[model samples]
Target: MSELENTFNFSELEDDGLDIAAIFGDTGTAEPLPIPEPEPADAPEDTGESAPEAERSQKQPAPEVEKKDAQADGETDLFAALAAGPKEAAKPARNDQKATGQVSLFDKPPIFSYGGAKDAIEDTSMTFEELRIAKADDFPELAEGKKVSWTVEYGKTTKVIADPKGTTIASIKEEIEKSRAFLDALKKAKEKDRNPDCLVKPKVTAQSKGIAGYKGVFSTVEEAKRSDKTICLIPARDGRVYEFRKTEMGDFIAPKDNVIEFSAVRAGFTPALPLIPRDLMGQIISFFRCFMNEWEEFEALAHIYWDKEQEEYTVFIPRQRVSKARIDADLRGSALPEERYIHYADIHSHNSMAAKFSHTDDQDEKATRLYFVVGHLERFYPSITARMSCGGKYHEIDPSLVLEGIGEEFPADWLEQVERCESRSDTLLRKKDFLHAFAALGDMPEESRL
Candidate 1:
């Protein structure tokens, strides 16, 4: 034995199933075996004792660990694997989509990458006058009037160019790119000018969703009335489309009149601005009664204008011909600048009658304005009703929406002043004292009736 072999017992390592001679020999000709990995318990928990002490302690090997020919066979198996040639990787299972040729739909030319050729197409069925043209400097590659190929990517116009590499668009200068983007937007807008696809179409849902789909939209009322869609939408001229609906009584494209649904539980009118002052409302009522007659009714017209600078409302009485039944006013408006004093409401008196909108009032109040009617002028407490009219349609609104409201505030101490007795007014403001004296007209003397 050599001095190195004699230095320590290698028989202990061989007992652990490792061949000492085979592993240390030169690997120039024969392939070296891969050493088998040790299992748990071969190197037990650390103890202060040495290897010889551990053998004396009688430590047991784990179950299923055959510390014999199993290691020898595993070592041979690893060497045999290295000596053999590499096997091909397993092919993935086919999904059988090739039979239907659907794979071609996902296939693309190796060079085209941004998107498919489908993105290059645009519906040019309707075209307006050329809104924009590529500037000469921005597009030096494009000829003035010759046909050119271009597409909008993320809304920016990009021109196809040939390159030494795969197909790609040439990089534009920063300034030129911005200019092209502006022109691209204009071009797209012009394309959608009269296109039906670009026009908003009303959608049908389980429940009514306002005008988005309830009415067919159009550029004009005339267009809406002539539309073939079941419902239509017309631009409200305020960036939103007007809701025009089809009615069974024939005006399919009629201007929709919204109702201020009166609810006993919920608030019907939520005020958007301050109410008209009580002093101004009193002036309107007193002036309206000036032309009141017991036998005949006279309708007087006046416009309520708002001065934004002063933030107060002023009445503008137009020159008119007044009679027992009607008043014809020259409503061409005065020399007032509309920019400052906006005519917000048109109010008229129904004299001694109940507050209501008449046919003549509806016909004349076609312009968009708030309309008011002062009725029961002969009574101590007159009635005033308010409504809004727009595009020849009317919407009844709570009079308190704009008016300062009825009744005056009494002194807070007046509540304590209420004694046992309270005197009632005999002015017959509401139903009159006739109910107490007489049930019907025949119950009263002929001379006692008005």
Candidate 2:
């Protein structure tokens, strides 16, 4: 017998010889009960005993009525017969149905009534114009002949390309990507814009402000970095302030005052970065290192809070409540405690796969302040990509900037173990090898792992 089958003995149950039939009545098929026969009618009672032959012959028979007279007066005879006494009850009409299970034309089936007075107020259908109006937002479109020009900023009202009539919110969002303004804005340390040109912005005022007063859209870097700031500002009609700088040419022909320096406003508020100690940074690195060799993805959540005694911000690594993990990991919102911390950061490993923020992730973290993606986890130096969403814009920030007191080099053993486990031909075949490597490190337990 196999080790598993031998480990559990089920022979005792069979030896018991349970009597299922006796316990729950006879198991043999039961005979149907016979229907009883109907009772016969009772005989009438005799008045007297049998008489002699002479006495019986003297008895007279009942006089019969004339059939001709009765036939002549059938109506009178029927009345006379009815007045005499009530006759035996006539047999009831046959009530047996055809039993064909098909609906009969003669049958009157019940009908359901689903309408009332309220139904009269409802319209069955709507026109195309009515549908368009119902779906439209408050943004007004420019007239046919009217044309306007506006500069594209990553985090401002200039993010959108056109009004509602010209394009939809989804189409304008595509422009944000094609324009490549998001990366440029990050490089310039500017605000991020959700809407590009062809897509519609979300309904929320904070999300929708990026394209509020947009007229003409400038998406290309060449157009955005145009030397002539006056032209870009002229179309916007905003009171934009600018500065002039002296070029190689002397002030005689082209003066410094003629040049424009900048024509945009800075953000009003920016999220503060937390101070992560070297120990916490190492802990976070170690936590992310667990999935370096695995083909699947894993995620972690870090809560940042102010340490009252230390007078510095500390990083709190909470238990990851991951809803799902494969190519991408979705961390459960319930894992994050509401009252404990006002600021939190979500970090996830991408397992050397897709490194960019997916559309789903963008929607999920649109309001998050700090988010990081660790890719190429099996490499010597892991790939770290971090972005901060604040003031209605996303800005790319370096890990070194936020993660302080951390050296570039990681432990040699960590990299070796990751590489060795990832070298397996089939990840499923070497699950034990991966587990043993982490177990040897003694950083976490098997039950607590992803």
Candidate 3:
């Protein structure tokens, strides 16, 4: 038993020796290793001697290890990496850690209090009171007791959010006043209902045919002679053709004729004049008396002037004269001729002129001279005149005698003058130069007869 125990003890001692050998091999021959000194937190003190190449190699690893330690502890290695210059990139951040929560300046509750007081309460809920306080605090300067009376947009419509006082109401009233004034001025500018001062009234005349004394207004003598009703002549002051049936109260109104009244005159008025001839005064007086039934009520006189060069006679009846004549003629029983006669000197064949005066439709041997007995009285007495000259001849007067006279021996110069007169007359007629032709006749020499 003792020998077996000695053998066990010897084996254990050998096992212990082998373990010690293994440890020595790993620790580089089993000497006690010296501890390394920690680097100073401050910058290293500079030495006069340059560091050895081996020491520099060792120092490079020291800075890198220190930088890694700093980054692991959440310290920035900005200076260490900057010292590395362009050779190294900045270290990447670690994303495994939980992030710190952010604190917002807007999240806190406001300080203002409103309504009834209550037990202290948490301000986590977004209540109306809490919201109002938050708004006030956000715009502290502008929100201090300053109600939002209205909000005015730069280019859009204004909005009235809160009426702290009557400021908005006052602004609205001012705008309404301006609008009303504008409307008043617009109404004045329209001036819609004003009446015109002047008016037009037409007068008409009625006439009957074969009724000797029946007076009428007719554009032509034949028309006057054909109508059965007592002719009423209503002359138009405006020269427009007015129908008798269209006139209101036409029957009660007396027919107006001869003299034109001042009230009846209008803008662009032109008077109609007679185209016949007689003693200048007699022709005018006769025209007025025949047409004007109220001549006695209005005294009127006709003024006549001869334009010898024009071979025309112009008659002017003044307003005063018309009024006076209306009074005189209306009272007077005798009626004057509405038409007048015009006579030209007989100068054709002297013998034929004499023969024409004696016979009706006389065909004389020397010349074909005609005579005319022209007058307003022709309707009453067709044979009032004996001899009259026309176209350079004398003839027995007839109502329809258009050609006055003819001459077999005309002077050569006289023929030329006649030709010129005929040409001028033709041009005047074509151009509707009635007024000019009348003036031309006056320009002709008295001796130059045609």
Question: Per-candidate TM vs. native?
Answer: 0.35, 0.28, 0.11
Score residue 325 of candidate 1 by CA lDDT.
60
Candidate 2 similarity to native, TM-score: 0.28
TM-score-sorted candidate list, best first: 1, 2, 3
The reply for model 3, stretches above 4 Å from the true place, is 1-185, 190-272, 275-278, 281-450
> Can you write out model 2's per-residue Cα lDDT over 1-450, one digit (the tens) per residue?
432322322233213442212112221233233434335444434546455654565454322223322222211222232233212110010111222232211121111112121111112133212223443342233111123221223232245334434543323322443344542442343122221222122221222223224222344324534543322222122322222222456211112232233344543324364555667655766776675544555554555555544556656665445422333334456343445454546666665554566566676667756777766666766677778877436777766667664457877788666544455567766897888887776876767666
lDDT of all predictions, in order shown?
A: 0.51, 0.41, 0.33
Better of 1 and 2 by TM-score: 1
Q: What is the C-alpha local distance difference test score of candidate 3? A: 0.33
Residue-level lDDT for 46 in candidate 3: 70
Tell how far residue 125 is off in model 1, in angstroms.
55
Q: Mark the regions of model 2 whose C-alpha exceeds 4 Å error after superposition.
A: 1-274, 292-301, 306-310, 314-340, 405-450
How well is each residue in 1-450 modelled by candidate 1, as lDDT tens digits? Answer: 432332334445446553322222212233234545665455557777798988866665532334333333322232232223111000010123233322211111111112221221122221111101322244333333233333323223343322212322222211222353432353344333211111111111223333443335468878877777656656566544355566777654434454222112432345555777889878877887778665666778887888889987888888888875678887574636888887788888888888888888888888877889888888898888888876777888988768775678888998888776433553443347656545677677889777
Pitting candidate 1 against candidate 2, the one with the higher lDDT is 1
TM-score of 1: 0.35
lDDT of each residue in 318-412, candidate 3, tens digit only: 33323321211232432222244222221111110121233432332123222322222213321224343334355344322322232257577
lDDT of 3 at 282: 45
